[model samples]
Target chain A: MDVIAGLGQGFLVALDPINLLYCFIGVFIGTLVGVLPGIGPVSAMSLLLPVTLSGTPESGIIMMAGIYYGSMYGGSTTAVLVNIPGEAASVVTCIDGHEMAKRGRAGPALGIAALGSFVAGTFSIVALMLVAPALSRVAVAFGPPEYFSLMVLGLSILSFLTQGSMAKALLMAAVGVVIGLIGLDQINAMPRLTFDRLELVDGIGLIPVVMGLFGVAEILTNIEQQIRRDIVQSRIGSLWPSKEDLKASAGPVARGTVLGFLLGILPGGGAVISSFASYAIEKKLSRTPERFGKGAIEGVAGPESANNAAAGGAFIPLMTLGIPPNVVMALLLGAFVIHGLQPGPLMMSQNPQIFWGIVASMYVGNIMLLVLNMPLIGMWVQVLKAPYKILFPLILMFCIVGVFASGNAVFDVFVMIGTGVLGYLMRKFGYEAAPLVLAFVLGPMLENNLRKSLILSEGTFDIFVVRPISLVCLLIAAALLIAPLLPALRKKREKVALDATD
Target chain B: MMLRRAEFWGGLFWLAIGAFVAWQGWLLELGTLREPGSGFVFFWLGLIIVAFATSIAIGGLRGEGPLLGDLWRGARWRNVLLVVLALIAFGFMFERLGFVICSLALLLFLMTVVDPVRPTISIPVSLIAAVGVWYVLEKMLLVQLPKGTWVEDFIPF
Candidate 1:
């Protein structure tokens, strides 16, 4: 009864004329950015963060959340049509989705992807609504030591699961924390790295850093490579999947929803891993495993559903624990801070409107996506054909203007440009920005809790282990840190043997 | 020889930065464990950074990474340089020449010079985007953007 009542109230708020309009705009832009290459949800969200300042918190966050999930729906369009993933999560969709397109089953592929995404998106929201509240209840009991350990666990998981050398990822995270330490120390008023600049005293703005790192950096990288895409030349047969097509996808959709929901709750690589895992699961489960890469409807259905579900699942840690699992969630965390709200356990109790409203709007946004994707698939295909030359300049212009307008400080714009160059170089050197951004946002919180825990126990370091939850978190972090070394050590030994033979 | 590799130089650069941060932290005084000061976290982090950089640099010295030139193998450095310069120029001139003029010029330069698009299309598209964004931010959102010092006196709209 209470949940239903909360949901009812949330729907009322989400359906408000202004909220509805912004939600539409958010999902619409999200879909466009998703369909277009070289522009991702992170860049789009960062570019629009300052603009959201003018609106109510609910509407602003509603739009941002819409962009987050709406992009999931739109990412599949390009993957199915042109074999190009519109976003990272859609990378798995390209394998079999494109094969289906090559077989002239593009329409059915798109339709199944859309339908599966809708089912998974809705499923995840229901799951989030049920699970997040219970998690929050548990999180409410967490002390400073527990929170500190949890943060450690979260960052460890992120660095461990990131697709590169864990050492490099950890190094990036440390660097990010340093960047976050540029302003006045949160505990003491003393400035750590400001160099006595009055501008730096207040701290580096998240907007400028994000705008540079994600927005402008993306443009610089895009400019370096020639933009080329090949669209499917064959006719798209039908918008709806056949009954047998639906029947074939039913099991995959169900399996993917559960698989994705579980994986997405992890700190890093959730969506990518989930989608790939879903594909793998579907293939292993299939009678004809060899048919997977050629043109299996199960492949399209499972990964698409898994990815969408994963996107929804990624929101849980952010909402309940205030720990962002990925960079986009980090930006969203920044948005929450910008609104002067902390996104921890108390958020549900303290800001029920924001919590429930965002949850309810996701439902509305999913319906909107289904409608948009089904009919506007052709339009999205056409939009993908637009030259990158035109889009990059426009994106750059938005970055410049957005950063400048955020604080009416031209200094911030310069900072953005500086960071953008750094971001570009980092990417070129195979360093990921995700860990850096997430760590930067989590840095202050991690330190504050760490100090608080230390103070509580007079710096003995046993408080973390004494607390059951904290002990569990630290154990997990230790495992994550040590887990990758086993395989690496084995490989090194194998290499030594090979060298000896040579 | 290792300096010829991007990873090596990059590692060394970060090492220097880490040392500087650590020195700053030391100057700030690392308090007792029970009552940590503002610099404690940074000091430890800086040390960690130095450790990582050392490994990276050592790895680079063993010729385990790509050459410095490999980073720019197919990159259009001229365009990249021009774009960076344009951005820096825009940042310097943003407050002086105003958002409208500065952005329009930057867009035009990027479109026509850096990558070369047709003048007719680039000019109009740049004009609309620059002006349209300024209008939305200024008029609709009620956010104040810099109107040029010269333009403000001449055009009193």
Candidate 2:
């Protein structure tokens, strides 16, 4: 009843003409970005933030939110067609999606991806409406100890699941924690690593570092080798899937939806990890495992559903607690603050208009994305027509100019250049930089909560165990960390490790 | 095999970087707890990075996997070098020549050098893209861009 009432309020927010306009614009821009390589939703959101801020808080937040989930639908387009993942989450799609493309079944692959995303996205939002408040109620009981324990759990999951050597992920996560500790110490005014620079007083800018590593870096890596694969197959047929395809995909997509939704609620392993996990699970469950990677419709269907479900599932943490589970969520947190709405339990009761409005707008946004992505598939394919020789120089130049324009400071440009170089090398070296970037954003929040928890408990470590919720999070995280070390899990891990290294 | 020297050398290079960052930490004044300082986190994190760097180096030495040769087949050094040099030049010239002129020049250089596209096509496109992007950013977007050397005199916008 409450969910229905809150959704009713959301409709009022979504229908406003100005809000609707921005929602349309957000999904439009999101598709454009999703169509392009190297410009993920995070970069698109951050780049447009300055422009979006000029509007009323609702417009800005709604539009920014639109860009976030809308891109998920758009990302799989390229993954299914040309095998180039439009964003990181869509990477798993290419493994089977492109195989389908190769075997003249491109239509089915894209059809399933589009349909699966739509279903998962809608279901997830409904789940969001139902689950968020319940989680918030549970969250309200948490204190500093619980928050600290929760962060530890988050970091531990990242350390364990991050796609590289365990040691590297741990090291990068630690570095992220350290980087978060930069600027003025929040507890006291003492400078720690400012190096006597005035700019260091505020520490590092989130916008700049994130833009540099992920945005600028991505552009540099991609521009050099912008190969254009033929996305449109010669004999493209019916857009709708066959009954066999649907039946085969139904079970996998259902399993993926459940798995991704569950995993999405967990910090650190949200959308991307869920997408990968879904692929592995679908493969494991397949009757003909040998057919798993070779144009299997379930391959595209399951991961697409999982990732979309994860996108919906991600709202659980952001709405329930003020904490953002990932970088995209972090950007959304900034949007919430911009809108004069704090994202916590208070948000539901205090600014039901804002809270419900954003939720309602997302429904509008999801419909808008589905409507935009399907018929426009032909138009999006034309995006590939923009010659890389022309497109890259312009995009790369924009990156250069964008970094400089943000502050008009030479140092920032230098930082972008350094990150570009670092990012390129990291890509070349087979090291994943996304985990580092994610850790970098989450590190500060974890630190503040950790310190607060410790100070509140007066250094009594038992605070975590005393709280039932925190205890559950800690136990889960601990089990995850230890489980990989057990002989059975280790054997599987070693095989994956060996294959990946080769 | 030593033919995959890039990976072995790359591993060593990262190890050096870990060491350098660790040294930078040592020079800073780590703040105390209750307001634990910035340097404190960096110092410890640097140590942790070095630990991992050492592990990677050991792995490389043990020949744990594929060599750089396998990965380097499609790699293009000319394009890589051109882009890197352009970026470094962009950074140094960003403030002096202004964002428009320096950035456009950088873009033009990249377009000409990296891809096999003709300058007849590339040059005008890059210039138009530069001028067009600058105009939209400054005029429509209301973003205050650098008044570059070329445009700073009369048509600054």
Candidate 3:
């Protein structure tokens, strides 16, 4: 009854013309960036972070949220037609989606993808609506130790999931925390790393750092390589799938939705991982696994559904626990912070309008994506035809403009450049930036929680262990940290990474 | 061999950073456990970084990674260098030249020099984008953008 009432109130806010327009703009831009490979949601969100300052918090957050899930819908278009994953989440789609296109089944492939995404996207929103409230109630009981340990676990899970060297990922996480701590110390008024510069007094802005690392660094990396696009020339005959295709897709979509929602709730698990896992699971379950990568509609259906569902599920932590589960959520958290609103246990009660409005907007946005994607497939394909040589410069210009507009300071632009170079180098050296960015956002919170817990416990470390939630979190984190040292587990971790690349 | 290994150099760079951070933490004064100071976390993080850095450097020393040159082998590294230099120049001139002039120059340089899109497309696209963006930001969004501090006195808005 309460849920229905809250949703009723939520729709009242979402249906407002201003919010509706912002939602449309968000999903539209979301799809655009998702269709383009060089820029992802992280870059897009950071680039637009400053723009949010001009609107009501709900409008800004609704737009930011729209971009995320909307990208999940848009990514499959490129993956099916051009054999390039529009975004990282769509990487697996290329294997089967492109094959389906090559076999002159492009229409069915795209049709199923959109259908599966709609089903999954809608399911996840309902689930998020149901799950987030109960979870927030549980989160309300959490103390400083629990919060600290949970953050530690979140960082550990991210580091554990990172490809290549765990050591490098951990080091990056450490560096991120250090960078995050650069400004004024929250506990004490003293600045530890500011070096007496006035700019350092406030610390580095998240927008500049994010744009530098994801936006500028991506352009730098892409321009150094020769990019190729091969759009399918065959006619896309129909937008609806055949009866057989729909029958084949129904199970995978269902399974993918469930699996993605469960995984999405876990910190560090997100769209990319969910999609890959769904593909692997569907392949294992298929009667003829040999057809896994050969125009199988299940292959198209499952992963696409999973990524979209995961995107929705990812919100539970951020909206309830005030912890960003991944880099994209971290950016959303940045948006929330900029708007002077904290998204946590009390948010639903304290800011029910903002909370329910965002939830209601997702429903509206998902429908918008379906309507937009099915009819405008050709438009997205045309967008893909734009040359990279032309695109990169414009992208670079936006990066500069975005960074400058973010802080209105030239120093931030310089910071973006410095981090861009560093990010490019880190990529070459095999370090994942996701863990670093996540940690950078989590660092200050982690420090504050730890200090608060100490003050509460009179400096006894036992406080962390005495608390059941904290103990469990710490133990799990410890196991993940220690797992890489075990040879068998190490091989398993490597296999997962290898599978992702495949 | 260690010097040639990419991991060794990367690890070494982080190691210096770790040491510097630890030194900074120490300088900031580590309060006791009962009343944790600002630097307590920094100090521990620094040590943790140093530990990880040492392990990475040791991995490199054991001859277990790619060579340094292999990172840039057969790559268009010149493009990367040019782009970096261009961005640095943009950063320096952004406020001085203002958004319109600076963005136009950047778009032109990148399209022409860095990757070289034809001037026909480049000039028009550059002009439209720079002016369009400047108008959107300054007028529509009401966000103030620099109008070339050096030329602002001469220009009539």
DockQ, in order, for the candidates? 0.74, 0.46, 0.87
lDDT by residue (tens digit), candidate 1, A1-502: 2678778888988999999988998999999888887788887888788778888898989999889888888999998888888887888889899999998999999999999999999999999999999999998898889888887887887787666566678888898888887888888789878887889988888878888888888888878777778899898879799999999999999999989988888876477768878987899999999998899999999999998899899999999988888888888888888889899898888988888899999999999999999998889988988777877888898888778777779899999999999999888776778788888888888888988888889978999998999999899899878876798754643453232222
> Which pairs in model 2 have colliding backbones?
A192-B38
> How large is the interface RMSD of candidate 2?
3.0
Per-residue CA lDDT of model 3 for A281-352, tens digit only, reads: 999999989998889999999999999999999999999999999999999999999999999999999999
Ranking by DockQ: 3, 1, 2
Best by DockQ: 3
TM-score, first chain, each model: 0.95, 0.92, 0.99
Which is the better candidate, 1 or 3, if ranked by TM-score?
3
Q: Which ten residues in a row have the lowest lDDT in candidate 2 chain A?
A: A493-502
lDDT of 1 at A17: 90
Candidate 3 residue-wise lDDT, B1-157, digit = tens = 7789999989999999999998888888889888888888889899999999999998999887899999888889899999999999988887788888999999999888989888899999999999999999999999889998897988776
Query: CA lDDT, every prediction?
Result: 0.86, 0.75, 0.92
Measured by TM-score, the strongest candidate is 3
DockQ head-to-head 1 vs 2, winner = 1
Instruction: List where candidate 3 sits over 4 angstroms from the true fold.
Output: none
Candidate 2 lDDT over A19-82, as tens digits, reads: 9999999988887777787788887787666666568777887888788777887888888777
